[model samples]
Target: MNTRELTYVKAFNEGMHQIMAEDPDVFLIGEDVAGYGGVFHMFDGLLTTFGDKRVKDTPIAEQAIIGLGVGAAARGLRPVCDLMFMDFIGVAMDQIFNQAAKMKYMFGGAVSVPLTITTAGGAGMSAAAQHSQSLEAWLAHIPGLKVAMPASPYDAKGLIVGAIRDDNPVIVVLNKKMLGVKGPVPEELYSIPLGVANIVCEGDDVTIVAIGRMVIEATKAAQALGEQGISAEVIDPRTVQPLDIDTIVTSAKKTNRVLIVHEAVQFGGIGAEISSQVQESAFDYLDAPVTRLAAPFAPVPYAPILENAYVPDAARIVAAARQLVERS
Candidate 1:
């Protein structure tokens, strides 16, 4: 019942510590994860706590790293493979989509792959295109893969614990910019069920559904809209795969308007899917079209100024919400 403010990185580290201690079959393997404590220090103190047998550092080969996880998980071991950067997932696509994801299904449920893939994503630190990209949509599209994006310290810990315990392969995509953000988190081990939506702020005028770090921006936008007498509800879809469209549709039915936001490019993003479902389910309740505010169709810029402009902010959300609300 007690809680403390912990940064996203710290919460993530604590979750790993608790889960690894509780489950002997769980192990971590990734580049710089053991000795370096992860590039973002999300794995700090884990190596010391669990030792080299559990926390292992691997070569820079993502394919081999994922392959190792697939094999270990199929053999009854729980492996948390750190992909370092989500953008590098392309290098190990075969192991992920072909092997790890399809193994249990192809084997007729004879084998289970409790593989957890943790990676950093989203653009903010100007890591450039290669290092920063919100690719949750790609993983969510896969039939056997589960994708989760934590927007706060509490969800960071809860989702990580949940993902590690899931029997199927789950990808926990952490935003690089939110690693230092702090929020209330329980000291004890906890697991938030995936496929559930969190109603960050309640309202009746408009629904603002945001993913990952954009949830923070959407919350700010909601506050700003409140000042203008335009009540805005904010929802965070904790896990994209097995998404809780019922929560979203219910909110849309109440508000009669919906706006989805994300850091990924607008085209072919998860927002599109959410918008489609909302419109289909709540078409009669709608006063306006379901809108989406997201990054432009371009690579994440390296320059700070350009990157700042590239990523959507609270101002953009506020403006978009205002427009959607005004549309009658």
Candidate 2:
């Protein structure tokens, strides 16, 4: 395991760079991704390294960008398309949900859509409503689509590498708040399977299942709970669609309490599905109802204070966990 300190964005760059270097068919396409190195600098020096043939930039059309990627992927090219912001997925919903996601299934598994969609998600840096949203649940709801929400640098690289090699379409949602976050990641190429869950912290009192940026908040909440003699286990479901429900059920059974956290809204969020699964699988084991900590069902606010309030934080998660643990 050749590991080194790296930020989340840098880890993603390493993953794409390694794959593009090894495979002649692997290339990148999106807006400003080639020359400007992407809005978040995910493709920093990739254009210079790979040149225009592989790292071509497109016009400001999300639909066209994704449509081209789906077409390219169908033609045996492993295209890593960056959509800039997850919010723009709405413009390309037809291409994503209808075409790229359903092609292999519609063709009786004869054709493959090895397309990887990378985009920035979550409410932070005051990106406002249109630019900040965690819409992974929307993609996860569609069949034949794999969704990956990496919380750390290691998972970012590993998941991206894995997504690039998969035979189906994969949406890799990078939490924008985590871009500058640093973690120890392996320098070598590594691919973490899509359905595996990482039990970040082990405890007995409660289970906290967090996705994307919420994982960091959940971890902090776990630490705070520990100080108060309340042990909380933290679980990160690296992939949302092919969810690792077994690990989550086991954790929930052991703790007898579960608290789900995500940057998405509370109503009809991914947490609802996870909560239902846990209730069905470990209902007898749970001492209290499954609680979810998430943003309100409203557009992301522009003000810093409102945006902060809109996003679930460590304190909110801690309070929710405390409630679940203390409920009689």
C-alpha lDDT values of all predictions = 0.95, 0.93
What TM-score does structure 2 among the candidates reach? 0.98
Off by over 4 Å in 2: none
Clashes of 2: 0
> Candidates' TM-scores?
0.99, 0.98
Query: Model 1's lDDT to the true fold?
Result: 0.95
lDDT of 2: 0.93
- Candidate 1 lDDT over 118-171, as tens digits, reads 999999988999999999899999999999999999999999999999999999
